[model samples]
Target: MFGGRALATLTRYRGGLGAAALAVAVVLLGLIEPTEYFALDQFFELRGARSPVAPIVIVSVDESSFVELNTQWPFPRAMHARLIDLIAAGRPRAIGIDLILDLPSARGERDDAALGEAVARAGNVVLAAAPADEQAGYTSLPFSYSRTTPNLPIDAVRKGAAGVGAINTPLDSDGRLRRMPRRQWTGVEWLPGFDVELHRVVTAAGLPAAPLPAVDPILINFSGPLRTFPWVSYFQVMNGTVEPTFFADKIVLVGPTSDQMHDVFATPFTRGRDQMPGVEIHANALQTYITGQPIREAPVWVSTVVAVAAALLAAALVVRLHPLRALAAVSLLWVIVTLFAYLVFVSGHAWMRGMAGTLGLVLGYGVTVVDHFVREQRERRRLAQFFSPEVLNEVVRHRREQSLSSSRRMVTVLFADIRGFTALSEKLAPEEVAEMLREYLTETTDVIFKHGGTVDKYIGDCVMALYNAPLQDPDHVLHAMQTALELQERTLKVSARWEQRLGTAIRSGIGINTGEAVVGTMGSRQRLEYTAIGDTINLGSRLEALTKEYGVAIVISEFTRRRLNADFLTRELGEVTVRGRTQPVKIYGVLPADLRKHPRAVIDVSATLTLSGAGESHPVATRDVSEGGMALAGVPEAWAVGTRVEVRCEGGQLPGPLAADAIVAWRRGDEAGITFVALDPESGPIVADYLSRRRSR
Candidate 1:
């Protein structure tokens, strides 16, 4: 029961639950390292390649250069010095040597002196440095090392370069290079990257402050796969084959391009065997700084907010749309989020988290759609349990669009209680009592249902039913009366069987009232009940308790009595003050089922008669009267059998004048009979008084 109720509550407040689930998912994503790189990589691929910048260019030591120089793997520093001198003549903005010159040249001091002289003449050069040891932890903290691996430069070459920066390119968990940290900690101080140091050399006056390592890494928006920048062969520069103007005022990077050099790394734009050289990667970074657009990534808080907002949008759509439409809407929302991420990255150089946002959208909307279906099914089940099948059908058919909120509706309520069941239980076994009560309650409920009433609930041996709720009925009071009458008969029949079986008697008293009352399915999201409550329902229960005092099987309040037609015969039981009430309520005892006509009557005299067709009035002597009809002696022949007339009885044997609108029933010579079409409430006391006196005499 608890589980079902909780499920129902979740189903009702699905929007909140969905939002909470989405928030949890976002937190988990943020806390856990990314296991999948497909979403972010796809975004990179979607943005595709961009045009290379003009200021940054690469001077490649390609296979051609190796063959022309006729030098082994690490070419002697003489060739590099000669090539650098040839390029320095153009007065380039800056020069970045992608190779590390930590060791002396094999050709001895002459080669070292030659390279140092060329570098010193260049005046603007940045040397490459790498961490001495591998970083191994979540934060990738570096080891204690005072100098860069391969050291920055030998004393001969170190004096020429403007500054030295690390060349450590960290790969993500997916083994793909997407971002590069701008600075690193070396236990003693923070070291900037080769590209950042080059940027300082190239644009000394316009440089932004160096960013810390913990700051969000720069998204490497690669311009192309490989060799995107203008490349000149080292041999070509040394041989004076390339024009000097090619390197003038340009930030030139000299690096190996031959496949055997092993200086290539995979980038976002990498495809198949086409990877970017480490020199070009640095060049791309330098260009990004020079252009003042680094392709920033969304901060942790922004990603979190985007995820939750996506979830909320999806949830709101699911709540308002059909399941199919919701599916379509969520799919569309995912697309929109994906497109938005791409657009932001393209226009603002900021990348949003696409994977978390899309996941939140799909899951949030899907869960709520399922919840709505479950809630509707539970609502139908609850309605079916309280109402008769006929009433249930009416509710399903007519009230499908109605909201199940509590509201005031004029409904007729009936309360029935077994009179002797409490005492009889003491004389019978527990099993016998249970069986007897079940049978009695079942019969009572069936009778109520047959008269088109809703069974609100069974309180021990008492059964409460309602009319004109869950479904409206024009003749609700009549239906309640009929149910009570039938229930009385049903109880008597059951009591006779019980007397034969257990030597015990069972009787029931029922009360009915008709008036305005609050009625609807009411409860929390977890549980619901269709019932009625108000003065009408309270009076009905009160009258049912009064049945034992009045010694009657069925008692109905005057509110119900006044709404009834002339088909019923009742005894005015006077007024009694009930509990929780300020005024005395007039009540009536429903006469037993007689099947005979005019079962209620009064002995009276002095009645005024008016014929339907004739205008003449005559005084008549009254013999007996019933709510249905009255008999009179010395009636004129003008009062025909089929004629309708108005009758008024003066206060001769009654407290007040009695007036009835009636039709003629039969005529025996000068006497005519009339049947009552309706009776005014003022005459009820007069009829009761006359009947009370007749019984006395």
Candidate 2:
């Protein structure tokens, strides 16, 4: 019961305009770095990052070496031998020359010839062979002062040892290098980076390409720099003045290293302002191959789908839930993901888009939540805490719980209208009309509630209602009748006053029927309303509509008239055909007769009071009565067919119910029959007994 009402309340609130606006808000927000969703793509392009599954070294031509060797632009070939000797001294695997010899130098052919003679003597020397800008153009294998040099062609070098493809790296859109390139375009097929290429070179030399224990300068950590790496003068090396171990068996990259004059690259290890030579960049690349710390990028389609789905999820939540709840739920989602990601990021070396995802979630939720909540707040700007709250607070309580369902319990419904409101409104000013209708509705609606009825909705001058909801009223039928009669009486009093004030009477007719009705919120996703539909409800409306025909103020169906135990004067108006109803329904009309005047006399076998005679408060008790399956002794003889009643004891505060007419359908002896009646369902047995005892006293 509790769950159903809560659900119904939430459904009602959901059908309002706020939900639609919230849905739009959610769609427009929901991602942080939707653009950089494919991070792995960027990770794959870094050349230096992908190199070095094996050890590598670089022989750089530094500025100092340039000045000292006058080898300024083109250092001679002998200089490479000296440095190669020093590296070879380490007994390393292989050597690679990142230095491009595509262009001839100013040193002349003499220098190149001598360099070739020396290179022929050397067993392990590698030089760079790169593609020319023009396919038809070819200068030399290794430029050394001429169009050609002492270096062998790439094909020859591949024969002499394992020559590797050393291709240039391209930058990403942002100009920030963050990824590693695995392979580059070869003349025919894609080929590996410098590091992988070096692995082939080393293993070809009968040495394994497996990772080795080498003294790394930056692997574990980096704080500051040493005076410098082993950098000998280029000319000094050419002149054979440097150590021979440098070229012994090391994997060396011979590349330019001048601060203002060499092909250099950015690296994670670059200090202050000094750039690492391209040779060292290759070295880093090789080391990266050894570690294999690859960052995976999501597929483009996956990112697009994820982003779009995230938006849809937000929309779903918005339309399905209240703005406040959806906001909290979204916040919880981010927190959970962030916590999960934090754990993963710390434990796993996986760097899968942290900041971007965060930005997406934060921005998405922030903008969406703010938009949703703010709009809701604006719509509820006149938000009041139970302003003129109804008597049956079940709706309010259900609203608090935020459920979305409807129950199939029975409820009594009532429909009421002013007997002549249409003509009255037509005669008055709009403002005056509004004021009059508002005043009457306010009072009449309150009366329905006072009897524990839910005012379903007000249609012009008519009010449709239900009973036994929110807080279940056991005597819903009884209350409906009471509410109807009460409203009729209040209207008479009010009408008389209005007549004196405005020289016109405002008569209202109330119609109430007690039966099961389907009451709930019903509508579209864009809009909805709280009301009911059923034949019983139709009958109730029909009864109210019949008031004009009957020339009586209050009308009710047999279903309702049979449940009251009060002294209300009602006449069975017989059958009446109502619109949309196939058969005529039995109905009744309530006359504004004073219960205190006749005191509901049950004419005994003793005396009879004239219809116009004075009366008293005492209910003439019948010794016996019978109605349907019910019979009672010492039952109030005043009991009429629809009289409201209570079970009473001598001096026990009437323990059961208020005075009912006992609904004497038939009378026999001292035993009179009384139909079971509930005057007020919300009103406990105490109020019933109190009324019965007081009336008897």
Candidate 3:
């Protein structure tokens, strides 16, 4: 049993658990390097461009040089020899030629000899080399690479160059070049990168050298996109269009930059057709080495912990707040995380990859919103049982705190009971009796709901309802009265049908009162009921019981009668002491205009009626009379239905002439039906006494 209870409790809070799980899952997925690299690229993009620390120049073999020299493809090796001779004359600290010279020139040995001689004279040139094949191995250290063999320059050029460095630029899984291997293993020995070799040469010439990190492959702090460094055409340097002093003490890199060469690759700043050439990538890498401030990535464990903490925090906040407020709070947190990561990247030269945390926050918030919506729908379904649709919607929309809490407030309470139901049930089978009760209760509940009343509860043959408790209704008293009248009208029709089928007739009585009452959910903690308790409620119940004593279908307290907005016909039933109250409560019987079959005293009285438009008086004799209406004979045919007339009755135990305004209800031949529209104050007691004496006989 304890296990079952535990399972139920877990089911109730599953939404919160689900949100936390998804957040952690997303953080784990972000640990993959490729997934986090995208955020690093955005940091670079947001930082824009900066000046490189080292003085570097690019000898670009670009379109402009091709057009100016009138040359096509692979300008003869003698031209490169002339360009190197011009740069060497400047006494530069270092010169890196970013072209592979693994094979002899097609222009013959003399062509290759000329380039080799230029390198011999310069004594500071670094030639590019590559691996023999695509095969490479990973070392135990993070991001380290090794190659088994190298494809070096030809013997002639190799003998002259100061160093032959690997021109291998490694790309991440997404094909973006952001880091370079500091050195590669060639099985026999270690080979330095082209930029590393240039840095060594520059330091050897007595320039200060920045210490490199112990890590094998290092992130390059790229200053910008293509052409960020100073550039001069290769052909211009050969023809002396550029001065040699420009290369003095500067690191010069010579390589292809034309679109036809196809030596460019995507970088952090690459967008649309703009890409960085391989030579410029080497320049950026060399600058990073010279400055010794390469971009360092946060350890995997540190980033993972931060991501998880951020996710959990977001989940806690969203579950406690309203959905709209939660959305705003989550959005603010996302911005802070992104800005913090960017600041660390720019100022501290570190990359944190904060996208994981932001993504987790969004997912947590989204799932929590869905959970709230589902729970609200369930609560709505539960409340729908006791309130009408309109009242239920209002309750859900506003959700006032005092709606279900105990409080004292002015309200109109109604009690309705089915008369003679116990005696009728005794004569029928249990199934038949249940069916009868269901039909009767269904009709009564509908009428109460139609007038915007809350059904408090059902006690066997009785239904209790309240107005202006859970939701406010300024005209609650009037609404209760209307509900009672309509309820009785419908019950009479139902009773007639049941009488024909079961051989017994039934009726219902309603009592309504308006006063201060304590209304709300009240009972044990395990089971509670929404009801009213006060002397006002008790008095309302007493009035319903008095209906049988006074032979009336509906009764209302003086408090309720005083609050009615519209005129209604009622008869005072004198004051009586109720069961629970010391004071005698005044009650009135409600008379509906269409109540035609009420108890009547058979009597004949002479009466004269004046028609409103006929301008004459007519003589009529009363056949029978009730407080609501009277049956008449010997009426003129001109008195049609809905004709207004004045009625004055004399004699027949009426101590004086009783005057009242009435309207013709129905007519057949010379007999007309008259219903009292208004009665003089003095005429009320006279009519009551005459009917009382006639009933006594």
Query: What are the TM-scores, per candidate, against the unseen true structure?
Result: 0.50, 0.40, 0.49
Q: How does residue 240 of candidate 1 score in lDDT?
A: 82
Candidate 3, lDDT over the whole model: 0.80
Tell me the deviation in Å of residue 619 in model 2.
99
Q: Taking the tens digit of each residue's C-alpha lDDT, what string does model 2 give over 131-168?
A: 32233344554442323222323332244434545435
Residue pairs with backbone atoms closer than 3 Å in model 1 (clashes): none
Model 1 TM-score is 0.50
2 or 3, greater by lDDT? 3
- Compute the lDDT of residue 139 as modeled in candidate 1: 46
Is 1 or 3 the stronger prediction by lDDT? 3
Runs in model 3 with CA error above 4 Å? 1-38, 132-149, 372-697
lDDT by residue for model 1 over 1-697, one digit each (tens)? 3455545445555763666466656556654226225666666678777787647778998999878878777888887887788788887888889897878887898989988888888878888776575434444456543333345578888777788887778887666776777876655677788888887787673434343324445766667667777888888888888977888878889988877888788777777898788888887777676666776766666666665766666766776678789789888777777788788877877667666677567667766667667866887889888999898887545432323467898888999988867788888999999999999999998998999999999999999999998788998898998898778667767876887798676778888888899887777645788888788888888899987776667788888899988888687878999898999989997764432243455456678888755767788877777655677877887655435578998865677888986655445566655666567888866676666666631
**lDDT per residue as tens, model 3, 70-140:** 98878787888888899999989999999988889999999999999999899999999876544355655
Best by TM-score: 1
- Candidate 1 stretches greater than 4 Å from native: 1-10, 13-40, 134-150, 205-216, 387-697
Provide the overall lDDT of each model, using Cα atoms, as 2-decimal numbers.
0.75, 0.53, 0.80
Q: Which candidate order results from sorting by lDDT in descending order?
A: 3, 1, 2
**Pairwise TM-score winner, candidates 1 and 3:** 1
